[model samples]
Target chain A: MIALDDTDRAILRELTHDAGQGAGALGRVVGLSQPATWRRIKRLTEAGVIAGKRLDLDLEALGLGVTVFLGVKLALRGRTALGDVERALAAIPEVQTVEHVLGLYDYRLRVVARDIADFERILRRRIMTLPGVGEVEANVLLSEERLGGPIG
Target chain B: MLDDIDRRILRNLQGDPDLASADLATRVGTSSAVAWRRVQRMKDAGVIRATRADINWSALGYSVEVSLRITLEKTAANAFDEVMAERARSPRCWKSRRFWAVSICV
Candidate 1:
């Protein structure tokens, strides 16, 4: 088992805010050499704390014009529905994230599209195809005062 | 090659990665040379990918957030490939955060 100390967490937080920072820059903040920082990052990746480096891009640049959240409810007998649900959603370009959640809702989706009609086509055709999916509710995100703001 | 001073340096950087090294060293109570070397070494390793990020929404002229859930059957590998491809086509799919843990006594 691997236990991350306070120092390790500090490094992670720094990376989260700005993943583009180089190890040399990170070392100055985290107190390691470029090599040592590299090693620690590799270890973190192996340990699952650090998944992978990603670039936060401009959404509109890719032609996704609207953002919305969808709450999906499925029948209790839908354990078998997982297969159809995943495959169908995977084909929608506007859908960015899929969350399996607990509560009255079974799943939540973050979607981006040019407009509501685009969302309707995907929802009616792909998402509703699941055998157990019963209720699908959507809340369009009008303005995000804080996008990707730090949690905790 | 890290002591108490080095840890202090790292802490400062974590809060604000945009600070200059010489300025950062001054705040960490160390000389510029030591700070520069430490930073230089960290860069040689992949511990840090970069330090500059321009995140100005006003300049970009757009806003977005997208979330979706995908349940897959068959080979988990094939499903994952499809999901990744979907993510790649959409710019809003960036910043994927996930948590998974497994424990075993070997």
Candidate 2:
């Protein structure tokens, strides 16, 4: 657990806002010199707070237009079964995010596809065949309203 | 709308955003000017949004990630708006979707 000061937080915010910005530009926003800012960023990266940079892709532009959440329940619940399911999920590229939740569902999976027909094909072909898989409730996403931005 | 060269450039950038235009040009087998222009065009077209750093929240002592599935009251005129407005004020409300799932760490 790393304790971040205000300056550290500001630097993180600025970097996550746009890492492509030069050290000088980031320093100007975060109230540090270029060298200082670079050093802080290096330290943060080394400390594992800053994992790496990512190129956020436009999914629709990439032919992934439909998004759905699957509330999954497994017939057999155990460590091995859970591990197997997770490994299977990792193998499927269309599955974007997976969360093991504490609720009526065992897992919540976010998946993207070209459309409903494509989604149906993936669901029938891949998702359902996983070991110990039982019931899955599909929730189609209509509109997404992000309240707060990504964590810095 | 991206050509083969643009896709190649994007693939390289997706791997490492820190690559300079010269390095990118070398890797993509294009002139530095062309590499820079293509990147600028993608940015301008919003195909490439903000290039941002990835933070490991788990490493920062955020061990618990929660997913909340909520069903809102559709009868109220401004129910969703009010809820979102209230949530937008809190930093802890990292991500909220209007449709179904919400992932947060407490």
Candidate 3:
């Protein structure tokens, strides 16, 4: 693991907030020259600490107004079943994130849809049809607070 | 109210928010000035919230991550608000979401 100093942490925090800021502006925030800050950012990128910059889209404005967390328990407990289910889940466009977890459920999924009816359709038609899928619990997200990361 | 060009620009930006205005314009088949204006308009309309650094928490020495589902008592009228307020005050609570009846802390 690459060791991070206070300056590196500061740069990360600043970038986490507004990554579109110019390197010179970032430098001003982190108390460094433009080239110096650029080098640090480059290093961080090379080290895979800063994965990439992503646009935070307002999904509500895009008409995707519903977010649901689903806990899926598979009936079969074999590796082949797991692979099949995972592959099938990945193909659905609305399935934002899929996590294989060791807990009450085998998989957890973050799904987005245009509305409640849309979500129900996706869940019944797309999700329930997956191989070895048995029990499913879904929680519809009412509101969310995106606290970026623990970098400050 | 996004046109084809606007959608194209947004798709590219979502993939790589650091794309220069000129490069983005080239990819979207528009003038740099037009691309900048469209992006500005989207930002103003709240379609584009912010460009954020996607940090790799595992690479940053945060190896273990947990998702906890907490259910609060429905008897309390202000239970949800109180719990949400408390979570907001905690720095370690990275992302918190209130579902229909459950609160997910990650």
| lDDT scores in order | 0.62, 0.80, 0.87
lDDT of 3 by residue, A19-101 (tens): 98988999999899999999999999999999888888899998899999999888767744677789899899999889999
Please write out the lDDT profile of model 2 over residues A1-152, one tens digit for every residue.
77888888888877776788888988999888999999988888888998899887776776778899888877776744687788898789789888888788788889999998999899888888777777788888877753323343
Share of reference contacts found in each model: 0.06, 0.65, 0.76
C-alpha TM-scores of all predictions? 0.51, 0.81, 0.86
Estimate, for each residue in B1-106, the C-alpha lDDT of model 1 and write its tens digit. 3467755765677567656788988998888898888766655643343553333222223344334434455566687578656655654444443222111111
Candidate 1 per-residue C-alpha lDDT over A50-152 given as tens digits, one digit per residue, 9 for 90 to 100: 5454434344543466677777776554465676676666567667778777665677778888676886777677677656777777766654422233211
How is the predicted docking of candidate 2 categorized under the CAPRI scheme?
A: acceptable
Comparison by TM-score, 2 against 3, better one: 3
Position B86, candidate 1: lDDT: 69
> Which scores higher on DockQ, 1 or 3?
3
Best by DockQ: 3
DockQ agreement of candidate 2 with the native complex: 0.42
Looking at candidate 3 chain A, the ten consecutive residues that score lowest on lDDT are A75-84
Alpha carbon lDDT at A72, candidate 1: 76
Best by lDDT, which number? Answer: 3
User: For model 3, how big is the CA root-mean-square deviation?
Assistant: 3.6
